[model samples]
Target chain A: MHPHDPEVTAAITALDLFAGLPASALDEVTARARVRTLGRGARMFDQGEPVERAHVLLSGAIRIAQAGSDGGQVVLRFIGPGEIFGSVAIFTDHLYPADGIAMVGSTEASWARADWLDLIERYPRIALNLITIVGRRLAELQDRVREMATQRAERRIANTLLRLARQAGRATGAGTEIGFPLRRKDIADISGTTLFTVSRTLNDWRRQGLIADDRRALTLVSMAGIGRIALG
Target chain B: MHPHDPEVTAAITALDLFAGLPASALDEVTARARVRTLGRGARMFDQGEPVERAHVLLSGAIRIAQAGSDGGQVVLRFIGPGEIFGSVAIFTDHLYPADGIAMVGSTEASWARADWLDLIERYPRIALNLITIVGRRLAELQDRVREMATQRAERRIANTLLRLARQAGRATGAGTEIGFPLRRKDIADISGTTLFTVSRTLNDWRRQGLIADDRRALTLVSMAGIGRIALG
Candidate 1:
């Protein structure tokens, strides 16, 4: 996408980070942005890479994950369209702790590190908006930690589905589909369980008609049922 | 504590959040601050309370935790001197999602919500610093989630103790002592395990001379051994 592309300008303006930024500021951001596209499964950035840019997802999704010492991986989050990531390192030390991989055809507008910091310094409101985003994510991660600590694997899985559905669900005849490819391993990572356990839980939920599960997508057939399980 | 308490003024001025603000702004902050003292185990704020203030821990520590559906609690972090909490609510809808309790006799300086927002608005550098604080915290929470998902209970506990030691430990003859009261329950909460399991792990570690564990404090006798465990 070109800097002057109308679509790019529109997306930048609509971002929560740009919610109240004046048109001149938004224009400057658009001017500084460099758009990059990724094919399905492309690596956006690798774990431990030097942080060079701040990314805003304009379309599609990316999975942020960390590899464990044992070669296992944990999915930190799935960045949907219009969300920001890869900026944390820019603000602190310049190292990406996790790998971000594009889950599908995706486009992101990123600013070189100097440019991003200069933008935030020039328009402090941008930094304020970022505080809100990071703060919210911190709160959500705390909830996830609590769920992993106190809830059973099945309940954790149920709650994870409920959360993702709330964030990315698309209404369909099947149910509220999560409109993204999610593997059993992804559920395992999010729920802090093993893939085998995740597979078993998914099978049980499918048998109970709590979810319409598949490799390509997951549909929550009974949110109330999931909520009941999540409550425990 | 008075608004002009030399120690309080010094602490606030040294905080990264208050960094680079003119003396006038700092003076304004000090004047508007309210100091509160909490005895050991006193709560700074209960979970679900209306978040109406931004807190700065001036002396002692605070434990940030959330109660789970099953009556279990997860200790999100131990905030020591110079750290900030309860400010996330200031930027959002202003509801505390978790409980913050004093881990010891603690003193905190807090700004009323409106006053704090006004200060940040007037001096955008304060807002910039808050973004850094929240951003760093988001990174830490992500690490915790990864540990819970991937590490065994023993490794998780080892990692937790190591982290606490690095953050709050005081060197002592017995070992590198964590200078605060930390019960097995705290370890259990931090490690996402049962108190029974934590006790057993402590006993095992004590037997191996890896730690000097007690009711009032814990001392690491073997940091390298514990590091090996955390590495797993």
Candidate 2:
């Protein structure tokens, strides 16, 4: 399919970024965007690279993370379909602040920075939407900062699971399972803990019958149980 | 002074928020803004409050923070003259996500949400500048998240002091002093460390002639010393 295929435009129109935009404006957006597909474990962009495009995920799971000086990775967030990423760096000094890695096979629509900037100027509503998008992310990061300062490892991990479940949880026969394949290391990075602590915590939660895990896919067997821990 | 005073217009023109706007547009901006004076210890806004207005700091020091469910506050950032604050929360669900408090007597120019939105539409440059401002803050938060996930408290504290110094440092006889009066608790909150840890770390730095503290004021005696610690 071509970049300007109606299917792509339909997909773009369905995204929150294009919410309330008229069809012609959507066409403008669709015309300028380029589609990028990534295999599992492939990175969309690395931190500190000059940002060329702003992206919106079309499908699959991608995790945004930052690497420490010690070579450890800290997951900033996970993105699924219709979510925006890499745009935040465009308004900055033009460098991606985090790495966007595909957790699973994924496809995204990307617009060159100049085109995106012109699009935002021509359609101020899109600019407003982008502002709201960045604002909410800032709020999330603020919450993480507060939790890291005040909460212990267990509570942070519980809250992290709860948050991921809410953001991308899928219902199953067992319970609400996190939609994406999540590893213990991702939880460690998100919760500011260690792999060992996450393993130990998951083991404890498993024994208590609060969760069911098969490899990466985890289902919260007892939302109430996890909620109690998160509240604590 | 009246809200439409030329002094206010000049200050508004000088702000990074209104960068690249023409004189008439600046006048329009000045006309819509209301001057607010906050005494020391007063809060500009609290978390979860409806965002009534967006603000630009005209003078004095302010600290932005968020309170966790445990009733602990984590300092998110510090603001000085010509810097923007409390604006990030405007575009999100209309609720402030953090608290902005005056550390000293402060004067600010605020525009009601309707007015600010109108200004952003009328002058897209302001909107662009706002994007850059929020983007930079987001990048800072991302770095803090990574540091919280990977660094020890001592290194985090060093980075915190370095950040504060860069944001609002005053070159004095001693060194580059943090422009605001910061207590140990605030430092702890900013660094994601405890007051005890901050106290111990400050003492260690002071003994090593890295910093000088008098009451609530802190002066970084050696930027090189702190930079080395922060890098670790």
- Write candidate 2's Cα lDDT for A95-177 as tens digits: 88788999999989999989998998898888778888888888888888888888889988898888889788888899999
Q: Work out the TM-score per prediction.
A: 0.95, 0.95
lDDT of 1 by residue, B60-167 (tens): 888888886668678888888888977797676578878999999999999998898888888988987787778778877787888888878888888889888987
Query: DockQ of each candidate's interface versus the true one?
Result: 0.69, 0.74
By DockQ, the best candidate is 2
Extract clashing residue pairs from model 2. none
For model 1, residues A26-130, the per-residue Cα lDDT tens digits are 999999999989999999999889999999999998999988666757899988888998888776667987999998899999999999888888898898788
Across residues B1-232, which tens digit of lDDT does each residue of candidate 2 receive?
5677777777888998888899889888998889988899899998889989999999888889877766857888888999988887778878877788999999999999999989898888888888888888888888899888888899989988988888889899999999888889889878888899999999999999999999968999999999999988
Candidate 1, B142: how far from true, in Å?
1.4
Q: What stretches of model 1 exceed 4 Å from their correct place?
A: B173-175
Interface RMSD of each: 1.7, 1.3
